[model samples]
Target: MTQERISLFVDHIGPFDAQKIGVLRGKANSGLELLNGHNIEVVQGFACEFDRLERFGFSPGAKIGSDFGDLDMALVQITRSKVETKLLVAQAWDATRVGGRIVVDGQKTDGIESIYKALRKLGIEPDTLVKSHGRIFWFERDETRPFADWLEPKLKMPDGFATAPGVFSAEKLDKGSLALIAALPPLAGHGADIGAGWGFLSRAALGHEKVTKLDLIEAEIAALDAARVNIIDERANFEWADVTKTSGRFYDFIIANPPFHTERTANTDLGVAFLTTAARNLKPKGQFYCVANRHLPYEVVLNELFRNVAEIGGTSAFKVFQAAQPRRL
Candidate 1:
């Protein structure tokens, strides 16, 4: 079906880029670009848990998922929740410059129908379209104030708190991560927590007598915030980064409940990357430990990366493993 609107308005800020906000997030890296003669801020997060996006100034860290660099319209991709869908739609509705538009996209399984239903509930009409079984909808509204202006005045993104519609663990704890925390050994000296979602494992590691210094590495900005709060201590160091992209000092011990999927699709490559990186980034004679879905094909990478790999434990939803390296970090 033809869409009623073609775009959505959003906070134009994230990852420092010369490209306009649209390009920064959706397009490629690097370019001289902006909007309305103003440099747009393009911000992004995998799984929609981003919260640091609120800080003002030139952001050099927002990872771009879609290039929204030069569109007169705004677009918000919600992969997690319908409430968030409503929030985004409401914001888009109130932000458009009369005749401007906004669009929302989501997988049908992710509750796209519910979002469409909610829009109808709001009396705001949408022109619907479909893609790969996913749904996309658009709407237009009259002149409205800056959308953020209508949100609670003086609202601030809380530390350790970042969220977006439909992102896993956006509202609270990640159950798998929590289980991993309950299983971790006491940490010591310096350690790194791989795929440390929202800093849960890293925080648990902090209770150990060792772990004088802890590196909490996560790819999502919002999760980094959670790690920051949960690991609030002088020894904690937070890195908002992809674990596989790490370039840093090796550690005495490394722990993780490595991410295994992007949405629902099983992505063994991500686990392999984590395992390989854990091996590469661990200190010689140190240990690398992780928890994973029992069904993931991670043994090959684990065997290749460590001097020794052993199954430590598991549950219906997870499996735990421990690895050690004889090679120098």
Candidate 2:
């Protein structure tokens, strides 16, 4: 098939994704190479995963898009969450043109079979294949269903801020962040909020007039979109970027309440990488402030990145740290 005749959707691209895509394409005798210049669309909300896809030569089709409404075919790599998985299937179904296919693959442990049952309820009986401790299923789109409810809603957060599902702390403001704000000292010059979620911390930093500028850096597009509405100051800039790969020595101060969990598993490396990024982005003698769960071992990571690190505030469940004089690596 010619490039103009084909459109592909691959979400959260990773090592095994290419093979899955090839398998799906082969079933249709599409004769498409990975680099065949097809209309390849990758939907990823996280900056780190998007960067990984770029390294694999799938640098998005036309800017970063979360909605998949204009595609011929879609391949979704399902997540473990029931809510997220249902949303993906709904979007894939809505995006695929009539007669086009929606291909889904995921591990059994991630609830793939449950999703299969859900698809059946939508009148889609997919051709299924099982391998690699997972299942791959595909079905042609003929009649679409009303799936508006599956779309994430703009739920109200504290102080009238808006947030949606899939974003961290969706239901309320984070207590650790509130503690960090209380302990935070006056900050001057430009600053960046490394994992700014819905602009809570960034908005708090703006209370001090000395903070001439602030950047709300977030990985998820949904969170950043809400942040734009919450933080109205011209000094506040929104960046949909991965903190670890974010560049520039522009900030005099940095703040974050870094995420340490991936799915249900604890991953301290994520928080460590955020600390290193904060250190690298700050100017000489610049300071970094962050809050962490009391039990997390971030002290060692902070000590390795900064000239001096000290605890500024703490509750029984959370601790705030102030690190100064970022050590040049």
Q: In terms of TM-score, which candidate is strongest?
A: 2
Candidate 2: stretches off by over 4 Å:
1-38, 61-70, 152-159
| lDDT per residue as tens, model 2, 110-216 | 78889888778766678876665667677777775755667664455666677755678777788999999999998999999999978889999998899989989
Please, what are the lDDT tens digits per residue for candidate 1 over residues 224-321?
A: 76566656699888877667877556789988887777657878877888877887877787788788887786776777777698887677887788
Residue 48 of model 1: what lDDT?
27
Every candidate's lDDT: 0.60, 0.74
lDDT score of residue 267 within candidate 2? 97
Query: Which candidate tops lDDT?
Result: 2
Q: How many angstroms is residue 212 displaced in model 2 relative to the true structure, after the best TM-score fit?
A: 0.6
Per-candidate TM-score against the hidden true structure? 0.72, 0.81
Q: Global lDDT for candidate 2? A: 0.74
Off by over 4 Å in 1: 1-41, 47-72, 143-167, 171-175, 326-329
